[model samples]
Target chain A: MDSMMMGAMSKDMMSMPGMEMMDMSIMQACMDACSACEQACTVCSTQMMSCAPACMNCADMCNTMMRAMMRMQGMTPAAMMAMLDACIAMCQVAMDECMEHADHSEVCKMCAQACQACMDACMSMKNTMMSMS
Target chain B: MDSMMMGAMSKDMMSMPGMEMMDMSIMQACMDACSACEQACTVCSTQMMSCAPACMNCADMCNTMMRAMMRMQGMTPAAMMAMLDACIAMCQVAMDECMEHADHSEVCKMCAQACQACMDACMSMKNTMMSMS
Candidate 1:
């Protein structure tokens, strides 16, 4: 997300209870990770391997998670937590599936790494939300 | 999604456990609804209303849901159920937000209707899955 858009999103979020104190840096990192993972998974899905379906699913989930963070007005802490959990689970599944083909395909290897990073970022966001509550 | 792609996806999904009995028509309807909802929400998000964030989130979720259905090889019944639940919840939130502005904005009114249709289609899919199980 760009600085101007972030500024706009932040301003919008300021009105939401429990959202005023959010760390923009953490959210930015998570969104970046999600975007990266989504791209990686989309590329990996083109390989048509057994892992392709999982990669496609992960890509979609990551994009959704990223957008949800950007659209905080549509979410409550509970909804955010649930979405994070779902994203994490989807990433884990994608990573595991991709790892099975990692040795045979470079794309799977890179996709798995992206999924790992996204899972970690989402977990961090979840932790931040937990502490705030 | 085109017929050729659907054919390919159908062939791939035939190998999944417990998916051989799946109804393609129901899945197709759900995917179509998701795609329509995603388009509507994306357009609504650009309107810069208070509902914009929710529309963005809903758009992402709908796209994800549609892709997941297309790539059924990556999904288990449990994962699909979870995803559908999340998508439905996001759509409901988006619809609620858009409904608040429906009287003022034709875009919001259309977006709300799209969300409602998407939600109903997803619920129908869930029902079909439950019956199959």
Candidate 2:
């Protein structure tokens, strides 16, 4: 997330064959949202709510999605779209589960919001991919 | 990766609406592979190989992919495919980076192998999805 890291990532992304068309800003936002959501979900999962499993799962998905964006050279457009869909699906599930505990726990509420934001970011990425396609 | 956790995950994966179409055994194997690869990549990244950045990225992606499978209710088939594609992309990047150091570091060699195995498992899952489709 630091400038140096972003510089490294940006340089890498720019060099990818098809990714020359990508909007780095959008990708950066998505990765940032995912990192925040993963942190929130990880903390929320340890709270032992019924939502724990879903939160745990969401944490993992967000982290994976973030890393995938960072390593775009390995992907095709189809693959990127598939990943976005999956990340959105996982966030939706986690958000629904966490919302159930929102009134009882502040962490659950915060985590659910993070999941929602991550879902939105991923949706944006998906739309970007579609437009590019 | 304990039995209790596996039981928790298996029970959740089994109850999803259309996920009964999913093969939990194969899914389980993939998750286990991701977890192992993440651990290996994490340790390898801290070793400061030129491959460090890629290893760090792979570590994050494998963790996310593992967690996503643990939360299947969040996903549709399309989403699952996308996630697998992203994961495969990330793993390929990590494997290629680590392969450069394979002769100098046993850990890199092992991590590369794990990435290869994970890629194979993911490809198998993709093939299964295609067959199911």
Candidate 3:
């Protein structure tokens, strides 16, 4: 995220109850990861494999998960936890499918790595949320 | 969704664990609703209101929720519940924001209505899940 965007985000964050202490840098990293994973998964899903649906699903989940982080005030800890689990589960499914064709497809390989990274980032956020409570 | 897409979905649904009994028609309706709401929210977000971020987040969440339903095998019940909660929360945020602009913007009015309907649909799914459990 750019400085201008961060400024806009920070302005919003200040008004969110219990979110005053959030570290914007960490949130930015998570959003960037989610955006990259969504792009990778979208390109990979057009490959016409049996894994296409899973790829599509993963792409959507990553996009959603990223946006949810952006609108943190709307979230409860329970909702955040659930979203992380869904993102992880979807990423796992996508990674499994992409791995089957990883030998022949570069996109699938990149997508699998993206999914892994997204899953990790979500896990980090989930851990943070758990610890905060 | 069209018939061909529905056919593809049904074929895939059969392979998902514990999803053999899913009614495709209901699933199709939900997917269509999600897709429409995503589109509406996306357009609404471009209006540059204070609600733009929330609208954008809601749009992404609805897309993800729709896609997850399409890839049922990628989900566990816990993950599904989490996603539903996130979707509902996002929709609620978007609706509240959009309602503030509803009197002035037709797009916001439609988007708010879409958000409400999406929330209702997700709640229906959550209720179904709770009943099944």
Between 2 and 3, whose DockQ is larger? 3
lDDT by residue (tens digit), candidate 2, B1-133: 6778887777776677766576767777898889989999899988987778777777777887776676665455666776788778778878988899899999999999999989988888888777777
Q: Which model scores highest in TM-score?
A: 1
Model with the higher TM-score, candidate 1 or 2: 1
DockQ of each: 0.53, 0.33, 0.37
Going through the candidates in order, what fraction of the true interface contacts does each contain? 0.57, 0.46, 0.44
Q: Is candidate 1 or candidate 3 better by lDDT?
A: 1
lDDT of each: 0.88, 0.80, 0.80
Assess every candidate by TM-score.
0.84, 0.68, 0.75
Candidate 3 falls in which docking quality class? acceptable
Q: What is the C-alpha RMSD of each candidate to the true structure, in Å?
A: 2.9, 4.6, 3.8
Residue A82 in candidate 3, Cα distance off native in Å: 4.3
lDDT of 1 by residue, B1-133 (tens): 6878788878878777898888888898899999999999999999999998888888888988998888777877877887888888888889999999999999999999999999999999999899999
Better candidate by DockQ, 1 or 2: 1
lDDT of 1 by residue, A75-106 (tens): 76766876887788889889999999999999
Give the range where candidate 1 chain A is weakest over 10 consecutive residues by summed lDDT.
A70-79
Clashing pairs in 2: A60-B64, A82-B82, A83-B82
Instruction: Give a tens-digit lDDT track for model 2, residues A99-121.
Output: 98899999989999999999999
